[model samples]
Target: NVEATKTVVDLISEQMEKGFEIPSDKVITVESSGSSDNVAIINCCFGHRVNETMGRVVALLLSARKGRNIGIEIDPYRIKLTPASSKEVLEVIKSLRPEAVPELAERALLDTKLLQWKIIHSARKFGYLSKDLDLSRINLRKLVIKLKDTPIYREAVREIFVEKMDVEKASELISQFGKSIKIKVYDSLSPIGLASREHAFDLLMPGKPVEALLRIFRQRLEKEVTVFHCLNCKYTVKTPIRLIGDLRCPRCHSGLIACFNARRKLEEIPKKELHRIANLVLSHGKKAVLAMNTHGVGAENAARILSKYYENDDKFYLELMEAERRYIRTRGFWD
Candidate 1:
C-alpha cells in the first residue's frame, strides 16, 4: 500500500510536469489499500498539509466569492467541495497571485492552536527545553518570545512546510496556471470523486443553521428544567417546560411563580431576589418562564425579550433561539 501510494504521487507529479492529456472516457484514479497510507500520495504530490492548506484555500475562495461557509474535504485523490463544483475551485485558484501565497499561508496559521503546539513541541524536540519540564507552569507568551527566530522556531515552521504544506509547489502551480494546465469543470462528480466524498474528518468551514438543527434546538429547550418558586407559600419545585401546566403553585394555588435556572439552589437565592423574580413571572406569565428555561437565557435577558412586542408564540421562540445562538457563539470569549 505504501509503495502504491508513492507510485501514485510519482505518477501525478510526472503527469503535472509532462502535460499529459486525458482521454474522454478515462479518469485518473488514486487509491490506497490501507488507512495509514490513505493520504500519503496527496501529501507528497500536493501541498503536504491537507487540513491547513485546504482550509486556507477554501477560506480565501469563500471571501473572494462572498460565499457562505461550506464543507470541504480533501483526500489523496480529489477535493470534495459540498455545494460547490470543481470548476469554482479552479477559478478561485486562478485568481490568486503566486507571490501572495507564502504570506497568506503563514498568516492562516498565526492564530491557530496548531502553530502554538508545534512551536512548543519543536522547542522540546530540538533540546531547547528540558524533557522533564512541566508545560502547564510555563507561560506560553514568554516561551514564544524566547524561541522566536531560533533554530527551534525555524524547525517548527519547516515541519509545517514539509510534512503538512508545500508552499513552494503551491506557488509554482499558481505561476504555471494556463500554461501547462487547464481548468475543466464537470457537471457531475466522476466515480473517483464520488468515492473520495464518503469520508470527512472535520468541517473546514461552518454552515448556517437549517430547519432540522432548529428543531433539535427547540427540543433541547423543551426538555430543560426550570426552577419554580411560589411567592405566596415559599413552595419550590423543578419542572421541565414540556410538563409545565397552569403556571400555578400546586400547594397554594397561587399564580405568583418565579422561575430560576434548575442548577440554582433554593437556599442560595436571597428572599428579596425571589420576590423580584416572582413579580416578573406575575407580569409575563408562562411565556417568560419558558424563555428563562432556555439555554444561556438568564432572568434579565428573559425579561428584556419578553418586553418586546411579538405577534405570536412563534416570534417569541424565534427571538429566544437567536439569543441562545448569540450566547453559544460568544461563550468562549466570556471564559
Candidate 2:
C-alpha cells in the first residue's frame, strides 16, 4: 500500500514538472471512517507557517490508517485553517495523490488599483477637511461622520489625495475606517504603478502584505493546487496552486486531504494508529503533515520538506509509510 501510494505521488509530481496531462486511470480515492483522536497530535508553534491544503491531506491519511473515519471542517471567511494535526496528515495524503485542483487563496489577488485610490481619497477627505476641525481628540468614526456631513471634508480630501499614499499605510487607515463606517472604500480607489526600480520607494507594492509574495507568484506562472476536506463535516476546499505555503481547508475545519505527488500518497492515520503514518514524512525539519488545512508548514512547504522521499520506484512511498507506522507504534504517543 505504501509503495503504491508513493508511486502515485511521484508520478503526479513528474507530470506536473513536465507539464504533462493527468491520466484519469491514475487517480485513486481513499476514504476515512470518521473517527476523531485517530488523527495524530502535532506541535502548533509553526502552524501558521504551514499550508492549508497540505494539512487536510495529512489528516485524511491519518484517519484512514487508524481505521477511524473523521471528516474535516472549515471556517466561514476561508482565511485561517482550523483543527490540529492538519499539516502532518495532509502531507501523508499528498504523497499519494498529486493531481489535486488549485485553492481559492491560490487565485491571484483581485486587482487592488481601485481599492487603493479610494482609500487614499477617503483619508485625504478626513485629514484635510479636519485640518481645521480640531481632529486631535476625535476618534476615527466621528471623523468619518463629520466628513460625510461637511463638503469641506470633500474639498480638503480631494486636494491632498496623492496616488503615493495608496499603499499599505493609506490602505490600512482606510480599511480601519471602512470597517467602522461600513463604507466600501476600495471600490472607489485606483492602483498606482509600481516603482520601476527596486530602490524606488516612490511606487508601493500592491495588495495586502500578508499574501504579497503569493500574489506575485500567481501573476508569473501556473502551479498545482492541493485540495482539502474535513472528516467530521466533510467540508472541502483547495489550496492556492501557486503558493508554497498552506494547504488546509477553510470550512468545517477538517484537515484531511488526498495530496498528489509523483510517488506514493500519504494518508492520515488516527492517533491510536498514528504509528502507521508518522515517520513516512518526518525528518530533521519535516513537520508531520496533516489532512487539516490549519496546521503545520502547509502543502507547498511540506512538498519541499518531503520531496526527498518522493520517487516512482515501486517501494519508495510504501517504505516511507511503513517507516512512519513503525515510528508511531514505537513512540507510544497514542494510547
Q: Which one is best on lDDT?
A: 1
The C-alpha RMSD in Å for every predicted model, in order, reads: 15.9, 25.9
TM-score per candidate, chains pooled = 0.39, 0.16
Instruction: Point to the candidate with the largest TM-score.
Output: 1
What would the per-residue lDDT of candidate 2 be over residues 1-335, giving only the tens digit for each residue? 55545544664576456443332212211211122233222211111112223233343455556555433321111111112233334344334433321221111111222222232345555455322333323354444444443554444333323321112222222233223322111111011100111112112233234245434333432243444334445554454434534433455433343333212222321222222122333332112332212123234333443556545432332333334333322221110
Instruction: Give the runs in model 1 whose Cα sits over 4 Å from its true position.
Output: 1-55, 58-71, 82-88, 125-130, 136-152, 199-335
lDDT of 2: 0.31
lDDT of each: 0.58, 0.31
Instruction: Give model 2 RMSD, 1 decimal.
Output: 25.9
